[model samples]
Target: MSGIYIHIPFCKQACHYCDFHFSTSMKKKEEMVLAIAKEIQMRKSEFKNEIVETIYFGGGTPSVLTSAEINFLIAEVYKYYSVSDNPEITLEANPDDLSSERIIELSKSKINRLSIGIQSFFEDDLQLMNRAHNSAEARKCLEVATQYFDNISLDLIYGIPDSSQNGEQAQQMSNEKWKQNIETALSFGIPHISSYALTVEPKTALNKLIQTGKIAAPKDDVAQEHFAILIEMLEANDFIHYELSNFGKENYFSKNNSAYWLGKKYIGIGPSAHSYDGVSRSWNVSNNALYLKSIQEGKIPNEIEILSVMDRYNEYVMTGLRTIWGVSLDKIESEFGSGYLEYLNNQSRKFLDDDLLFIENGILKPTKKGKFLTDGIASDLFILN
Candidate 1:
């Protein structure tokens, strides 16, 4: 089974910490949607051998579009692709855009899942991130959304400047408030949550603010503490810490993301979207105007990279180490031959001895201590060719 990812590269406003490709303008929104649908139809042969089990509307902010526009795109996928009878279609939304009427409308559509960008329930944190939604709207939208959609995932951001940091005292989100944010989200009874630490990427508003001393940078130690709190609270509440950043209750794990982590093929449509077919990876241009122009000319504006043996192996190790499934030693041996298997075994010795990693039933997984540093551990296991 495979998946289709459609990127809606438009946002109502830019979040201070965001570095994703998106425009705050809706001038080209209609043209972009049409291009995305055309690109989906054009790339049908890419996944001709596979049945689509998931269709993900990732973004900019998918909620910016009307329900009719979303359904139109879904219809295009149905027309050109062999979709599973019960495909999981998810839409990424921001709280401000998900009004009561919008939620009701979305529920009637084919979209079954909602990934709300709640970020935080605290007003100060929301302002710090420059999120379009206020604290009231954040809670209000979820209250309304959960009633209409059961398979919902709320995104939360931790690691903002706290009282200890030298930022605007009014904007500081204390540890106690952070815990309250977690508790508030739990009170919603949502099935899935995708939490992430506040990161400052270069060229982002947050980065420039920090550089100009207008805002304090996010502290790594603080983020680690927040992450610990998240895991402890979620696990205590019966949520499975399935992946590093994702937690789901039982079978509610995101199929679209899970398919990617499991190395299933998926086609990404729209500007700045990335795709993979077992051996090669491709990404569309990030420029909206250029993407539309190329697609209008019946050409897909993208770059492709053919994966080498080492590239594929490194990716497997990287993605596998971050999830509950872990990396399979037998698959490594069968797929990459004995030489790579031996290399992995030798490279994993130090981490295994340090109790950071463990092997159970031929699956190598990161221990709780190693989960926070899975990327570093995965890098150590990479085979440099």
Candidate 2:
């Protein structure tokens, strides 16, 4: 099975911390949409042998589009690709876009899942991040959204200065405030949550603010502490930490993300989108105007790289170590041959000895002590060529 990802590269406003490819202007929105549809049709043959199990509309903010516009894209997918009987269609939305009427409209549409960008439940943090939605809008949207959709995921930002740092007295207050955010989300009974630390990426407004002393940089230790709190709280509420940064109740884990991690093929449509075909990886040009022009000229403006054996093994190691599905020894031996398997066994010994990783049922998994450091651990296990 495969998945189709449609990237909507337009946003209502720019968030300070975000570095994703997007435009705040709506000048080229219509043209971009049409180009995406054309691109989808153009790439249909790429997945000819596979059935699409998921269709994800990710972006700067998919909710910026009208319901009719969203339906038009979905229709384009159905027209060209072979989709599964009950494909999980997810739309990444923001709180300001999900008004009562909009929620009702979406509930009647083909979108089965909604990934709301509710970065924080506090006014200060929202302001800090320059999110389009205020605290009230954040809560109100979730209240209305829960009535229409059970399969919802909310994005929360941790490690903000107000919520995850400072001296002992300040830390206590921050913990309480952070706890309230989690408890508030729990009160809404959200099934899935995707949370992350506020990393100041280069060329972002947040990084500049930090440089100018307008905002403090996020501390890694503080983020780690907040992550621990998050895991403990969610697990107590019956949510499984399926992925390092994702928690879900029972079967509510993200199917699209799971497919990607399992190395299933997926085609990404629109500017800045990416695609994987098990042997090669490609990404479209990040410029909206350039992308539209290229598609109009009947060409896919993208870069592709053929994966070597070491590349595939390293990717598997990176993705597998981040989820509940640990790295499989037998699969490595069978797929990558005994040399890679031997290398893995030799390299993993230190982590095992340190109790950071353990093998059970022939699968290597990070222990609780090593969960927060999975990326580093995974990198250490990489088969360097």
Candidate 3:
């Protein structure tokens, strides 16, 4: 009802740090697109009575798809479901795939928002991560994209491995270099930015590279330092830290993701995408071959999980703590009962006393100093799933 997330599972090349589900081969791309449209129609009954407010295109690289293909899937959504009058439709795209011609063509489509993946403007960072785009392509894409799109968001990766001198893992990124990265992004005058640290997940190319001494690992301390600088710089430029990893100017917050943080129901279509209702969660199979096979047979290959009370409580505490809208005490007591609220209060006592968490009015929120540690604190306050 609130949103629909369509996962495009094809990419031109692999990024070392990415762990999302995708495939490099485009042999089945056409079939995949048809299957996605079919799935969208199949799930229409789920939201028959609800108006869809947002539709997000996220994936291996949504930009890899042609404008016609993208529009076809969007057409399927409109045919099957009741969409909002002015829905927020977002497409997640990579820099290399967003050529000058491509950007102009996309501007004519129904998509109203663009989430560009411009991880960094430096050659070292791009090459180290094996990004398909060069630094020039990143800058060029934004220059063209900004001219046609008013609603745009940039993705920046901080705390990238910085050991060019000798490849030492503990060595931190130069403070000035990190500052420059932030400054370069600000020059574009974009409305929103979603930044994150470069984490090393096991079995990924980045992880393997680090294990074989091909690249240095990202340091937590460096990430914290970069995060601090990011907050200071973005806030000074009139951006609000609405969520831990998201910053937006006035009237520019992401409607799709906001719904998720607020625990609203939405459906995910395509291979490896997830869906959620108020009481249960579901996900399509991650394997593209299997997903296509089942969809062609008129069945959605998905697994469902019914959430228990404790499971719901823990999820609430986790998501609620990460955003500007803190957890509501009254809602907790009324919805989850007094026992869970009491347990939360007891578990959060240490955090509240230490200034890591605070109670303002009736909501519990993290302090500036404690913002980065919100996840850990939230986990400690969980009701036990």
Candidate 4:
């Protein structure tokens, strides 16, 4: 099935470690919203006759938009696209923007799911991350959101070197606190979670702080420890470890992201968003004003890239290995030809023998050890030609 992704490129504030395209100054909010609605009508031919099972409102923080605005956007999609009967409409919200009343209002709209950005449950960690929410707000928002939607997902960040708790808590690194957060979410019977390790991108405020010795760099060991904990904890809670950084209860997986991993097609609107067809991918310009102006002129500001055989092969390997389903050798052989499949099998032999990967019924799957070096392994398996 197909999907639709709408990127809202605005945030209340920029996080120290963020490199996403967004503007704190919301001068173009109205213009951008109108542009997005127009874009849906403009791109109707892109997904003609394709039943859309997922609609994701990802962003600089989708919660910043009013319910009325959100409803208008949904109406536009319905007016143009052939959406499924029960499409999963998700909004990415920060904790501070969510309230019990706000969530109730959101529930009345077409939004069926919520992906809350609760980076951490501790005030100190929030301060370090420069998140717009406090610890109390993070906890309270989840409780309130649960009352409105059972299909809720939480996002958490771990492995920040600045995170610490003294005395009894000092015995554990900051990552351990994430376990408590997970348990709290489980208590609420939340359906999904996306956990990631803290990463300092170049040119970000976080990188500058580390460069100036105002903050410590992320530790590899700490990240590994947290990753291990995350996998074990989610598994114990009977959550499906669907993707590398995502877990979901049965039948609650993100259909939008799942479509991406499975190589299904989708259309993306708004700045800094990417779209995929069967054989090619494209991305919109990252500049907000540029995106608005172009769309307003009845043009989609995007660059397209037709995938070379090698590019498609490499992407298949990379995305497949990150999910629990793994890569199917037969599909690879059929799609890329037997020569490419043989090359992958030969390269995977070493990993298979070393117990880093296992093959079952023509499917190549990674072991726990292999998961840590997934990207490297995928790179090696790629056919450069």
* lDDT of model 2, residue 241: 97
Q: lDDT tens digits, residues 61-174, model 2?
A: 989999999999999999998999999999999999999999999999999999999988998888878999999999999999999998999999888865233222223226
Displacement of the residue 179 alpha carbon in candidate 2, Å: 1.2
List the RMSD of every prediction in angstroms: 1.6, 2.2, 1.1, 2.4
Give me the runs in candidate 2 sitting further than 4 Å from their true place: 163-173
- The model with the greater TM-score, 2 or 3, is 3
Worst 10 residues of 2 by lDDT: 164-173
lDDT of 1 at 201: 92
lDDT of predicted model 2: 0.92
Give Cα distance to truth, residue 24, candidate 1, Å.
0.8
For residues 213-237, could you state the per-residue lDDT of candidate 3 as single tens digits?
Answer: 8787788888998999999999999
Clashing pairs in 1: none
Tens digits of lDDT, candidate 1, 112-148? 9999999988776777788899999999999999899
lDDT of 3: 0.92
**Residue 333 lDDT in candidate 3:** 95
